[model samples]
Target: MTAGMPAEKSMNFGPSARRLLARLSPQRGQVLAVAALAVLSVACTVIGPKILGRATDVIFTGLLGKQFPAGMTHDQAVAAVRASGNANVADMLARMDVVPGRGIDFTALRNVLLVVLALYVVASLLMWLQGYLLNGVVQATILRLRADVEDKLNRLPLPYFDGQPRGELLSRVTNDIDNISQTLSQTLSQLLTSLLSVIGVLTMMFVISPLLAVVALVAIPLSVLVTRLIAKRSQRQFVAQWTHTGALNGQIEEAYTGHELVKVFGRQQEVQAAFAAKNEELFRASFGAQFVSGIIMPSMMFIGNLSYVAIAVVGGLRVASGAMSLGDVQAFIQYSRQFTQPLTQVASMANLLQSGVASAERVFAVLDAAEQSPEPARPARVTDRHGRVEFEHVSFRYQPDKPLIEDLSLVADPGHTVAIVGPTGAGKTTLVNLVMRFYELDAGRITLDGVDITTMRRDELRGEIGMVLQDTWLFGGTIRDNIAYGNPNATEEQILAAARATFVDRFVRSLPDGYDTVIDEEGSNVSAGERQLITIARAFLADPSLLILDEATSSVDTRTEVLLQRAMAALREDRTSFVIAHRLSTIRDADLILVMEQGRIVEQGTHQELLAAGGAYARLYHAQFSAAAVDLDEAAAAGAGQVPAGVGPRAGGPRPRIPAS
Candidate 1:
């Protein structure tokens, strides 16, 4: 199964194709206009061949009539032929309205030629107009479809993104949509024109000669059979081609995004091999699809040629027996070619149609995904806007069978700093995520200042909170622009103040462009520590009543971290803050400390109290400090002389002194 795909795939071609066509419902008026114009244009085109046949007849009759005696009347000429024992020839000549005693009449022939030319000219104009209108209809339909897909994306929950590959999702939104546009643009008007031409030509063929028409009709079943056989096989290949396309895109995106890591680990060959495998899969699928569908046009043309040959033989015999006129026979031959031409065109378009519907199915998959539950229609508001948060017997699980957090309860009063510490996979981050309502609870509820969080709109609840995560994200823009993202309407003074408070202004001032420095798409222009600082500055600018810092200062050096800690101390003065950190020293001054293990709080108290209690928090703190003490002693023994006990590492060393908490 493709990443993030629904359990049931919409692989049926008929339903998917019909759904694609349904998108054009909004442009019904334009579609109807295009259809009407196609009918008129085909009517004119079908009439042109018949009128041109008259011109051929006029020239032929005049040439034959002039060969007879100069003064012979029309009846005398026919009687002369019959007297000569050529009764069939006499009957054929009787059907022609020819003046036997005269040479070719150029005036009547000119009139017939003029009418044929006029019919073709009108046909061309109508075709051009229909194409213009259909372009609008196709573009409008695609525009609306794109909008719906974008809207659907915003409504999807975070877990949907967690399971989906970024590159695969991008392919559906961009590449798939582009393919659909091209298919509709190239196929819509042409399909309509081809179908109408087939109908108009078939009508004219039967009118001219039904026996010959029946001979021409023999190819229809053969054509249909060949098309069905080829299309059935090629459709599967087309689906595989698109699926491989998305997989290849996903691999390429992951490789490029982690190019530095790949180089660091010396895994370039492995990455290349994976890429080659995916590329080969895509190539094979594409070749199979094209080669199979490619056979259809020639197959159709061959069948039509057989019918053409049979029609020519039968029409000739009928003309000789005087059952059909020379002019009508000429028209019937033209009609046969016209009838077969449209079938060939449709056959040639099979590959595009198949590929287009495949892309449509992928796009519809995104649209049909289950969305996040809707927000409350009449949402409750936090009137006083205090930062107090409470979790009342909250229970949740990522999977239905595996319970992660069960009946957990906690509370942080307004203007208090609550610090959480735990080993990996202990639900530390999950607790903070619950406060943000990133996922809904399986049972019980969470509230902010006594209002149920679910009852409040997500945007409104998130607006009053600021977060700085462990992984910093920065877009391509000036540093000033990135900082301003946290508060779009913030003044220049406010932005600069936040930067100074977070110690970002210190290093930024030493750079060439300072605040105006442009970051690359990956933010490679700056160090990781600087990137983290920028995110911190952004959160500071937001200045929310609630703040959550998840290892926010992990990337910075000791001196910079010390400066940031002082700034954070002032920032946390009157706001409720939830700080999750592995570095115990950073949270020693927090108002309350909660040590968690396996999704439950094993201990909670002030730092000194927890250490004296000799519980999980004490073990964690002693373990961290003992490791630091051992490292310092090892460095001293390796260097000059064994240093005295309880001393620090060499000055300006990589490791910082372990302060007493």
Candidate 2:
């Protein structure tokens, strides 16, 4: 979602500026020192022109008497002087202040140049030092921002991820952070330097000639107006660019990740169209932002050039009419250019600054996000499986005012495998999601070992509940890593042991790398059956007091299914487990099979007991295995009978033959 437009969204430059300043906290001393040196440099810059102007004026008024040669006639000297009266003339002149019969006093002018040059050197050195310090601050700030963003991502509730694309999250963390970095590392300090220089130049202009300075500065406000207009247009476009970039990245991720499905469906053209649309959106936004910001610099230069012409024409006429000295006009032109330089700097840098701000806004939007339903202050370190679970009159809704499970109650004793079978959207997942404390309950309580789950720390509650979701997702790491994900502290020996318990050893030990072989994200590189086994191994490694297997065998072939079934039976030994599945046949061995409808358990009992009762459970069981052929295939697969390949395990497909009944 785009950032909300609150009533307070108006540009408050003061706070943003303050935030920028605060990031330079530790280096403020260096900034101040550099600023002082820069001021000295500006002082020298203004004074040098005045000194040169004074020298020219003094020479024009004959303030410097001729150190003319004695042989020179008055007429010859007068002719030379008349020709040199033009300000553009550069004829050699002798100083009036020279000691007679000695030498010209060149020391004053030399010292003036030396002082100015020294100030420039000092200023340059200060600027370099500032560059280093500010960069260090910028890098440090970005690192902190990234770290904080990551921590937030980790802590946010599971539902948060369910609603957002992974690619968008990646963009926020990586691309957005890079934007802030580029702005800080390059444009930020330059803007500051230009702004400071502009201020100093303006002050100098006022001191030298206020009236002329005002005329030169007329362009400053005009350029700022143009910059603001351009910036407003570019700002909207930059926001759009980043948003579309994220969407495009998400589409690409989905495409590559789902390439097999896409090709199988022959939806290449469909995917191409979607991608093209997203890419075009991104391209247009980027181009528009760039084009608008690009126009700012040229506009600024136009205004600057116009200002320069105005100052030259006006000041030159004053000089020609004896209202100002030629030297004064020269100094005035320099000051006029100085006035526009800062405006140009602001225009050039505004684009970078806006991007950084937009990025920060996104980043802060995450940081400012509501915390993952707060955890317990001091959660118990729950290790022992007094796995007596109870959902005492619990109620919940994913959305407010739209309750899913209401006033529902259920219980499972320790070491019992509870199979909960329900139709789609009957609150099966919601019940478990609440039990895991992924989402808070609206009413009532769920307890494990007589302690309410909400009162315990989320990590502590989840730590003991090993989960195998219907759609298994593994990380980009080794087999060992995936197995040990549920409990990272698991020893290598323990991981192997867990793998063995889950039948993972059957496939894993045969692999070229065994436990060392890496798996892609969501186990994309591995066979579906193997991935299921890996997750089962994860549960085994966790050795949790409670286990949740949601459609654990639904995605696997019958061959793997048999192995998983055996492993499931083994895993149920001496632990509380919740089995959620639509394939009701597989959960026949559960200690308690619950037939749920509309978030309420209509029937629950042992297989034979439920069958004898001829209730909802019995009806479901019969509905599932009503066919004689289905019974024969299942029975044959379980070793009591045999079925030929053409007959299949279910309707249509052929099934592998086994022994006859």
Best by lDDT: 1
Q: Which pairs, if any, clash in model 2? A: 64-96, 65-96, 636-641, 648-655
Candidate 1 Cα lDDT to native: 0.89
lDDT of 1 at 582: 98
> Model 2: how large is the Cα RMSD against the reference?
6.5
What stretches of model 2 exceed 4 Å from their correct place? 1-114, 321-328, 380-384, 568-570, 626-661
Model 1, residue 100: distance off in Å is: 0.8
lDDT of 1 at 268: 100
Q: Candidate 2 — number of clashing residue pairs?
A: 4
In TM-score terms, candidate 2 sits at 0.84
lDDT of 2 by residue, 281-353 (tens): 8888789878989999899999999889888888876665556676677776776776687778789887777
